[model samples]
Target: MLISDLDCNTLKTHLSGQGLRFRTGPFSVSLRATIPAIARHIAKLYPHSETLDNDAFIDFHITTHQVAGLRRWLKPQVVFSFDGYKPFKPLPLAQAAAAFEWGLNWCIASSSHQYLIIHSAVVEKDGQAVILPGSPGSGKSTLCAALIHRGWRLFSDEMALLSAADGMIHSVPRPVSLKNQSIEIIKAFTQEPVWGERIEGTTKGDIEHMCAPDSSVRQPPTAIHAKYLVFPHYQSGCLTEITPLSKGRASMNLIENAFNFNILGHQGFEMVSDLVDSLECYDFTYPDLKQALDGIEQITSAKP
Candidate 1:
């Protein structure tokens, strides 16, 4: 059964009691939280996600609760815990849902070492997957949001899971995070965007999460061989440009964005090198979303 199968009262009851176990891509997550906002967030954002049995093997066991003592009554903050250990400090209760999303990202990137995880946004169209690895403020999520709206399937918004053995990209589609001005930009770009509350004054500035497209969430997860490695740069008034990169340079760029290259050591290095060799690496810079979408469409639609 899906999370949508449960009513609000039932969901809250489960959350307050044991937890809500749900399947996200390859991982089984059991999330326990009493925060009403988080309940609403999941109801809207993850309604298509499947709820797992209670006895299932959970990959990430998480809990978010109001911090104890006067803080819970005074400022009202929420702390995120994994396996009973608190990994991060408390944040305002209003940001509980955002905290859960951030906490989940940490869980996957830190523990899921089976895959060569890279800090990138991945989307696919007609069997061609594009990996967008960009630094903060490089318009990665913004461009990803645009592509998914234009009929590309979103693999993930935060990271790409490249399998070590098969060299294929795995899907981990969830809510697309939009920060600061990008929030309004995407709201204006899309016809009807289902967004969480605008969380203000966080470490990442104003933040909001746009619910994943129904197609991206409902579709069964599958591995896709990536065709393009595009590093996006959103420059104001700059003409759309796509410049090819050498394999050597592309490998280095990917390593810099990788989450556990040193942990995997030689295997990770070889994986990055081999993946770059097969991909058409490029530096993509654009001023407007429309032009960016067109530029990507042209390449992804071409003969492989």
Candidate 2:
């Protein structure tokens, strides 16, 4: 069934009477009025994958009609459908659809490549993938946006799916989210950046997101041994500096940022450990984007 065959009208009826369609590399997601801003946030990362198709790598089949009824009749929670499978807990109607789309992408990546998906942002220069893994306030997305504008390729901005056996970072390019000042910073930096509607009142405060270009998404996923695992913190007035971090410390930090490290158990530990061993680890701090980009270029160029 092509994307056209899926009953768009039926899907719309189940949602609260609104619809917006978005595509990412091999995935297609349709959102209703109740959809959250985050879904729109990551859609920019994969531009080439935007074409509607019957054979999507992942398809989110969302219906709001069953959420309340399922919770009341079967269980006391919301229900979401993925290729017809039901998730019992209902997500906030606004974010639920997008969340399901992301979840489906996660399921596909993990199952197919033995990748442990970590909530992170990634940018590539040359053949090396630099992963930025952090919590919401960590300024990763902003930095990623800057780098991509300055010629770095975006691998992903939300989920960094790294292969367990090979240590190559898989590309799952999605939107790059920028909050408050970062939005303005990126807007001023790029001449024609693609952005969705600005969403307000999220836990991270007022927010807006930009989608990566289709060109970035269509490029083949590169298998670069990690050259740097730099943890970034954007502090106002602080000079850009890169400090060395031990492999063991980097491993611990990575585990904390991982989405399924515990699920992978000892193998997870070893995969991450091996990854750190093959790369340089650093704690990067910057008050300016240019300086940070310069530092990153220096690090990447110095690598053999």
Q: In candidate 2, how many Å is residue 289 off? A: 2.1
lDDT of 1 by residue, 1-304 (tens): 9898999999999888899999987889999999899899999888889999978999998999988898888899999999987778999999998899999988998899899999999998877899999799899999998788888898999999999979999999889999999987888898766888888999999998888887887775568899999988889999889888889998999999999898899999989988998999888888988888887876676654
For every model shown, what is its TM-score relative to the native structure?
A: 0.97, 0.75
- For each predicted model, how many residue pairs clash, with residues at least 3 apart or on different chains? 0, 10
Candidate maximizing TM-score:
1
Overlapping backbone residue pairs in candidate 2 total: 10
Looking at model 2, report the run of 10 residues with the lowest lDDT sum: 36-45
For candidate 2, write residues 1-83 as lDDT tens digits.
Answer: 22223344443342345333545544456544333333333233333454443454435544333355655455433345554
List candidate 2 segments past 4 Å from native.
1-47, 50-113
Which residue pairs collide in model 1, if any? Answer: none
Candidate 1 Cα lDDT to native: 0.89
Instruction: Give the alpha-carbon lDDT of every model.
Output: 0.89, 0.66
Q: Candidate 2's error at 236, in angstroms?
A: 1.8
